[model samples]
Target chain A: MSDTSKKEFKRSFSGYVEICENMPTGMITVRGDLNSRKLKSAFSKVVGATLPKERKVTLAENSIAWMSPDELLIICGYDNVSDLMKKLQKELDDQHHMLVNVSDARAVFEVSGAAMVEIIAKLAPVNVKTLEIGEIRRTHFSQVAAAFWLTSEQRMKLICFSSVADYMFDLLKTSAVVNSKVGEF
Target chain B: MLIFTCPYCGIEADETELTPGGEAHLKRFGPGSSDEEFEGYLFNRENPKGVHFERWRHVYGCGKWFHAARCTLTLEVFGTYSAQTFEPPEEIKERIRAKRPGWKWRNFS
Candidate 1:
């Protein structure tokens, strides 16, 4: 195939990758159901090499369980996605868990810096303060069904369904940007 | 929004995610049991001050149903656990009363 033809095929065939301009976000859903025991073991193994120390785990320096069993719904830096997913896949494969790559099934975004909760509450219904650090919840932002995971007080990660990803990203970014501009003055 | 803790989701959602199944941890009996035995298990509750476990649905979130513990007097929450976690405690388990009782339910399933 010619390079030009290959490029066209690649663009059309890339079904799972979705990008957002305002927040510079991307998303994917990995499907696997693991009970508590299996989840603990799998998470420990997968996160082991990345942090690989008891001290880090105790201090919660890197990763955490943002939700309960059956689904983990991880959050990581956009640049680290390839490396993170590769490591996660290896761990799932080792455990023989049924891992389905649904990366294309959702939209992801990074809402960071201070005042993140105050900003998100304009759309989200639940009280953000009640969500302890390292917890994840499936809730609605505005009318959008979304799953949110907090990596830190200043940073939160959210996933909206793929079909509405564009709408959600645009809505959130537009509001947050407008608010940031207001704060700047 | 009401503060409701989902056992499966492990957090208090906006009451929107949870379908309130009424009081948590009620006990029912099978058909084989005697009328009085069945009644005892069917309807009885202790008005207590300490940990009281109740059931709730994570309908909007995980869709996994579970129970939560709340204090009657203080309203202090103990913890939330899956409905499948263990058998309902003996105290709250089946036996009905002839006097004023709880609400009616068509399907316990």
Candidate 2:
């Protein structure tokens, strides 16, 4: 693969709140009848964790989140996506299911520090103070839609469409600047 | 600025996370129906000022469709329920009755 063709990525800003673009990661969407025992078991086996209910499960290097009633998003190392998808296909062959690798379709950003929640609150309606670790919420950040989950007390992971990544970054920067000014006053 | 709870995801989603799907529980008037019935199904709406039931999609949340019971005049939400059924659940109707006596929307009294 030519390095020049690879899109250059960077974290646009960092200060009281640190923003960093995560390394390329694998994302797979699994859609099926979640009520089916066979499908549920297949998903648990492939992801090495049970399908989370109204929350996300993080195991070592992978995280599985419930995206909808019938859909789940699995995040893992970039190189493991193909193998994981194949394994899921084999395990779910007897059932009706759809698996797609969506790694390149979205961008993930890790935001942390004292002002992280305040910055997120400026962009989305979510009350970061009440959001528990491991809980995930999908809502509009500024004008674009995104999904976010807290990884720690001061850290969160936000995923948004790659097409709107730049717009989202700008919103974050503006929010951070405004928040800093409010703090100074 | 209405907030609705998605029955599937159990999240009290903000209006921004949801998309209005217009009136809920509309009976379809398809083939063999009268012109009046078809027109009513296509265009006619109660647009009531009192208790109303509507459909909403949690587009940014769990992506599930759900029903919301609210008063149009006051914008007070009575309750939210799943959209899988043809009518509001009995519990939701009861709740509405407690808050607004003799409130009638469709079949619910």
Best by lDDT: 2
Question: What is the Å distance of residue B80 in model 2 from its true position?
Answer: 0.7
Give lDDT tens digits, candidate 1, residues B3-109. Answer: 65664545566656667665664556778888987886767654454445567777657767777655455665545666875544333323211221452332221
True contacts kept of each: 0.44, 0.78
Query: How many collisions between residues are there in candidate 1?
Result: 17
**Worst lDDT window (10 residues) for model 2 chain B?**
B100-109
Give the CAPRI rating of model 1: acceptable
Tens-digit lDDT track of model 2 for A18-54: 7777656799998999789997788668778777876
Write the residue-wise lDDT of candidate 1 on A57-110 in tens digits.
Answer: 122323433334454444433355566567767756656454434445655666
Q: For residue A114, what is the lDDT in candidate 2?
A: 66
Candidate 2 docks at the CAPRI level of medium
All models, DockQ values?
0.28, 0.80
Off by over 4 Å in 1: A1-65, A74-96, A131-133, A177-185, B19-56, B67-81, B85-109
Candidate 2 residue pairs that clash: none
